[model samples]
Target: MALLYIIIIVAFIDTFSQLPIIAPFAISLGATPMLVGIIIGLYSFSNIIGNIVSGYWIDRSGPKIVLCVGMIFVGIVLFFYSIVTTPQQLVYVRFFHGLAGGLIVPAAFTYLGSRKTSESKGRIMAFSGASVGIAAIAGPALGAIISGRFGYDYLFFMLTVLMIGCAVLAIFFVKELQVISSKAASPQITSLKLTKPMLFSYTSIFLLMFTLGILTFALPLKVEELQLSAELTGPLLSVFGLVAILIFVLPTNVLFDKWNNVHLMTIGLVIICGALVSLSLSASFIHLLLAMMIYGGGFAFIFPSTSATVVEHSGEAKRGKAFGLFYACFSFGVITGSFFAGALAVSPSFLFLIGALCLLLIVILLYLFSWKPVI
Candidate 1:
């Protein structure tokens, strides 16, 4: 459990550590606003590719090995980030970083979700979720402080050390579970049955992550455009992370245990739509705060519900493949959201409205699907 927590924290840190630095880094490289968007968007694009491939690898190799390799890759790539002097070079690094990240998370979640009992599964996942939340809150602050004090080079060095530490911890402490051999083995571990529930869960994950990508990519840029200090951006993001942690750690599980996963997920989707609408209209700090709260709540509710449902419907032997597919959906959505939102951000008002429209479309789709019985 301790090792798992370490891995989750490292993954979260790796994912978010760049948020506060991206704008400044791009400007230093002589990038225009659109180029900055491309750098950020490219990370998600590469992440999707990595998630699909790594998901398959996880099913074949098991979580422990894949996770360790992922950590090593992240550590090495991040060390190179500080030295890159061109936007194109940064884009390349971000792509590979996303690929490494793709390996770590889905494998970790697959291992946790495949535990013997649902109750235990929920608890483990909740803890993992909380770890991510804490990292989201802390990583930006750490990045801002490091960047402000020593520069981006030193920040990358620190992250490299942290990633190496996570790798060492995983190697020393995480126990690898043996794959169950069965008649199902003939099809290969990477092959799994896809059912209606799995498809629905994938859709939910895609939409959920889509919303997150929009917020993560757009909000930071918005802050920079307003010339806000990194210190202020760090705290705002921390507040967003804290709210998400609260929702993920508390009410989400109760609702999941007491009600259907579908119901919980549907409600989460509705909340996300509302949050996006709020974001579209936000013109001040207070408005952004309220939007973040709503966005965070929606995120907290949807992630665990979707994850738990995927685990519920998957067989033990196919759990890794199932989760890989799930993560693929998630990464793909994030990639799509970042790319589209980045393109749209040339005009802030248009960008927010487009994001809101996308969420509204998702809400309608959720309702349409809900009206039909789950197969």
Candidate 2:
């Protein structure tokens, strides 16, 4: 279990570490604002394809093989980041980087999901969310400091070593799930229809990540616009991770197991909307920190609820596929957010304001339909 969590952390660190640097890197290679967005979004676009394929393979071969393979592939791809001299070259690298990465998350998640029973799903997923939060807290700050001191090339080299190291550990330490066959499988086990709860979960994640895409694209530029060092971008983003970790680890984590998932998701969306609005109006580092804290609170609520929703709703046979599709939506949302945010070519303030409007619309639709807790 600890090794599993460590793998999750390392994979996410690879992701969050890039958030502060990716756009700037593209700009350094002479990418225009719109081109930067495309470069940022192209990763998620390929990830959607990787995710679905990875899920199918995981279901058939079990998670251990998929996990090891994905980690190695991602590690190999990180080397390309160091070699790219042009924005066009970086675009191709990002596409493959995303494709390789798409294999990891669902495998980790499926391993965790398969091992836990329903009653414990929420708490267990809270622990997983905390793992992600830890990466979020560390990755950005470390990436900024490292890239600032050493350079982007060194950062990618270090990440390559870490991924390869984790893959070796997983090869030796992670156990394969025994594929069980039953004679009396239910007819509906083969049904492809998604339940209302699954839809809500997918919708919530898409919106959550869509807003994140906007932040990822806008926040670094926001720091630059205010004449701050780009290093500040990473720590500013870490504030949200710190806040979210507290919710995941403290007594507040009980809310996930006790509260209605939809209600919690609604509250989270509303808070996130407010946070986006606050970010739009922020003029200082202090103000950005406050908005990030609010965003973290919303994130804490949404992540556990949506994750547990998938575990509770899907059977063992379909869990990998369910998570795969779920994260595909997640990647698709990021792709939409990043590309559109860049294409609109607005100031950071206006971009955040638009994100706020988009989230507010989601919240309103949730009520307009009068959604209930499916469980």
Candidate 3:
């Protein structure tokens, strides 16, 4: 479990490290605003492929080996990123990096879900969620400092080390379980199967993450448009991440335990809609901060609820595939959101309004389907 926390932190840090440096890095590389958007969007484009393939492999081979390979792959990619001089080269690196990142979430979640009980599942997942929060809180600040002082190469080097460390931990500490078929299961093991409930859970994750990607791309541009200093942007983003973690690890989990997962998800979507509306009106730091807090809180609730639902709905044999599909949805949403936001860059306000409308559409779908809570 401790090892899992290490892996989570490393993954979170590696993934977010570029957030603080992206704009400045792009400027240094002579990328225009549109080009910068493309560079950022490209990472998500790669993630779509990685999530599906990695999920399938983990389901077939177990998470331990898949995780190890993913960590190693990311580490090598980070090293390569240090040398990227063109937008095209950076795009290629980000695409492969996203593919590597696609493996980590499902593999980790599937491993946790495959355990014997939901109570333990919740505990481990809470810890994993907290680790992500901590990383989100710390990563951008660290990246900003490193980039401001030693430049992008040093930041990438630091990420490479963290990725390598994650690989080492996985190799030494992660224990692999034998892949057992339903027919060969011991009496203590319950046979599980994938169902429609699992598909809905994955759909929920995909929709939420898709909106999140759009927000990520749009928010930075909005901040820049407001003429805020580059340093201020990192701290502002950290505020959102911090609020998200705090809400996710405690209040949101309690809510999940007390309420139906479907109901909680609906409420979360509503909150996101409100946040987007608020973001559209935001013209200052305070307004952005308020909007982000609400947005982050919504994200906090939706993420774990959706994940827990996937676990609850899937059978033991198909847990890996379910999680893999879940992650695939998440990655695909991100890719779609990024690409869509980039293409629609002419009006950030309109983009946010569209996101809100999409959430409303999702809420209507959920209501119409009368989706039952998985947990």
Candidate 4:
């Protein structure tokens, strides 16, 4: 279990450290606008593929093996990143990188879901999420420093080293899931019959990532609009992840356990709309800071709870595919949200206003439809 924690932390840090460099590096290689988009976006496309396949594979191959193989594969691909001489080659490399890395979440969550009781799933999920939050906060900053000091190639090499450490932890410490010998008791994984709650959980994932992806696209422009130092965006950006971590680290774990997940998610949606509305109207650093912090709180609330909902609502054999779909929604959300923000961002405030209104509409629909589940 502790090994799982270490693996999650190291894997996330390694994965995220590569984020900020992708587009700039592609552009540096004379990649055109569309090709650059392909270079950057192809990773998530391949990731969606990875998520869907790994769901089936996780059950057949085993989580420990799948996770280790995925980690090692991505680590190895990072080495290839250093040697790419053309945008096409980098594109090929990133495509595979996404495939390999995508194995982690579905497999890890499935493995955890099988092992942890419903009562305790909240704590474990929150712990894992907090690790991710810390990594997200550190990854871009660390990526910049490492790339600056040594070069982008060297940074990839360092991530490879960390990934190798993750694989080692997986091999030496992570326990394999216990297999059920009674085949009759093990229900066959049917067609992906998504239910109402599961469907909502997936949508919740998409919405969560939409907020994050658009923030990346829109927040920097907002910072520039306010005439603040570009450096201030770092703290502004970090507050979201930091607040999520704080909420998870605090007693909200009880709410995650005791509350209706759908209700928690609805509250989170409302708060995120507030964050976006604040960003849409922000005229100063303090205003943006408040919005970012609010966004963080909302993110903290939704992520773990919805994740638990997806897993909790799934049957054992169906869990892999369920989580696969859940994460794929996340990837799709990010991809679309980023493109949406990029396209509509001639006026950053207006872009955020549009995003906020879209979310408000969703909240209204959810309330009206009851999503059939809860508040």
Candidate 5:
């Protein structure tokens, strides 16, 4: 439990802290507004590739080695972020960062999701969800403060320190999940096709993460456009996290064990669409806060349900691949959102509207394809 919690903080701070600046830093390096997304996109793109490879490795070798190596690798690469002088260099470095850095998270999560029994899985996953909320509550604001006081380079330096600490934790404190011995023995994976629920898990998480990319990348720039203080963005962004803990994560943890998930997930999807529209329309700090709060609530419902879907559907033998593919969708959504959000930054509403429309389409597809329409 302590190991999982520690990794959660390390992952959250490490991820969210650097995300807000990836685009701005590229622009600072003489990349045009249009090109800023490329650097961020490259990271997600390479991260997608990393997910596939890391998934394979996690299944075979277990997550401990993968997590430690990825943390150390990313910590070292982030040091290079401080010295890069050009957009091209930043892009290359970010791609490498994603390729190697990608190994840590899915590996950590895969182990956690598969570590426990069916009856207690929700409890474990709830703890995981709550940790994300806690991190979001603190990480972004702390990141903004750090950047404001020291500069982005200093933020990177601090992140290196954090990742190294996480590596140390992985080495001495973290306990490895028991491998499914038969699954571990099989080296030949025939395909990556998922069952219906798992497919829904992948798609749902992808859409959710897509908005995260847009929200994370676009909102800071939006804050800048509104002539708001950059520091304000962190708290405004963290609003969603706060709401998630209250309305989504904790409640879902209890309900996940007993509830019919389809209705809950649909409601979450609706809330997410509303959040996109609200965020698109927002012009004031208060409005941004409201938008984020809605987004966070939707996340609270969607993530736990989706995680349960994955855990319930996946075989112990294939859990690593299952989670790996799940995160691959995560990277794709982030890449798509970051790149397109940059292109659409001229009018943020368009991105939000597009997101809402995509969700509507996905909802329809989910309804049509659902193998069991119980809810």
Candidate 6:
């Protein structure tokens, strides 16, 4: 279990590390703003494929193999990042990278979900979110520092080594569970079904990460506009993670179990909307930091809630597919947000405002549709 968390952390670290550098790296390769956005989005777009496919594989073969192979493929892709010279090549790299990465989280989450009892699901998932929060804290700062001091190539090489090492750890230390089988599970094909809880969970995750995509796409540009060095982007992002991690580990985490997931999601979305609006209005570094803190609070609320909802609703046999589809929504949201931000070529303020509105729309629909399920 500890090793599983470590793998999750490393996989996410590989992701968040690129947040600060991705824009600048593409620009260095002569990518236009639009092209940079496409380059960023293409990864998530292809990741949808990987996420869906991985579910079937995880159900059949088990998560250990998926994690190990995914890590190796991702490491190989990161190595290509060091050698790519053109934005087009970077696009190819990001697409494959997203695909490779798409395999990992579903595998880890499915592993956890299969084993977790109902009473412990929310708390345990909060810990999983905390692992992600830790990565969010470390990844950006390390990315900026390494890229700032040693250059992006070296940073990519370092990530490649770290991923490969984690893969080795997965192979040796990660335990393989006996894959649970039932009449429903023995068939290789698991029919993907959409239920109310799944719908709520999927919608919430999409909106949450969609806003994040916009933020990630816009933040570096926002820093540049404010005449701040790109290094500041790391700390700004870290603030969000720091706040989120506190909420995840502190006593507040218990709310995930005690509270109604939909109600909690509504409250969280309201906070996130406010935070996004505040982000659009931010004028200084301190203001940006405060907005990110608010965003993190909202994030901590929703992440555990939605993840627990998925586990609580889905049966063990279909858990892999449920998570796979759940994360596919995750990738799709990022793709839409990135493309929208880039294609519009709007001010960061406008992008943030749009994100706020989108989230507000979801919140409204949630209430109107009775997002809560009947027992």
Q: Per-model C-alpha lDDT, please?
A: 0.76, 0.87, 0.76, 0.82, 0.77, 0.86
Model 4, 225-259: lDDT tens digits are: 88999989888988888988988888867788888
Pairs in clash, predicted candidate 3: 192-315, 193-315
lDDT of each residue in 1-375, candidate 2, tens digit only: 888889999999999899779999999999999898788878888999989988788777788898999999999999989999999999999999999999999999988888844547777888899999999888877788899999999999999999999999999988889654323456465333587777878998999989988988899888888887887877777788889999998988999989988788888889999999998899898988899999999999999899988877877767778888988998888877776787788899999998899789877886555465555
Candidate 3 matches the true fold with a TM-score of 0.87
Badly placed stretches (over 4 Å) of model 5 are: 27-35, 117-119, 181-193, 217-232, 248-252, 280-288, 342-346, 372-375
Candidate 2 residue 175 Cα shift, in angstroms, is: 1.2
- Give stretches of model 1 more than 4 Å off: 26-35, 85-88, 182-191, 217-234, 282-284, 345-354, 370-375
> Which candidate wins on lDDT?
2
Q: Residue by residue across 37-140, what tens digits does model 1's lDDT show?
A: 78876777777777777767766677788888989999999988978989888888988988888788887887787655446555566667778888888877
Candidate 6 colliding pairs, count: 0
lDDT score for residue 264 of model 4: 82
Candidate 6 or 1, higher TM-score: 6
Residue-wise lDDT of candidate 5 within 314-355, one digit each (tens)?
666667777788888988987776666766636666677787
- TM-score for candidate 5: 0.86
Q: Give the clashing residue pairs of candidate 1, or none.
A: none
Q: Flag the better candidate by lDDT, 1 or 4.
A: 4
User: TM-score for all predictions?
Assistant: 0.86, 0.89, 0.87, 0.94, 0.86, 0.89
Candidates in descending TM-score order: 4, 2, 6, 3, 1, 5
Off by over 4 Å in 6: 27-35, 85-88, 116-119, 182-192, 218-231, 283-285, 344-347, 371-375
State each candidate's clash count: 0, 0, 2, 0, 0, 0
The superposed Cα distance between candidate 6 and the true structure at residue 224, in angstroms, equals 6.3
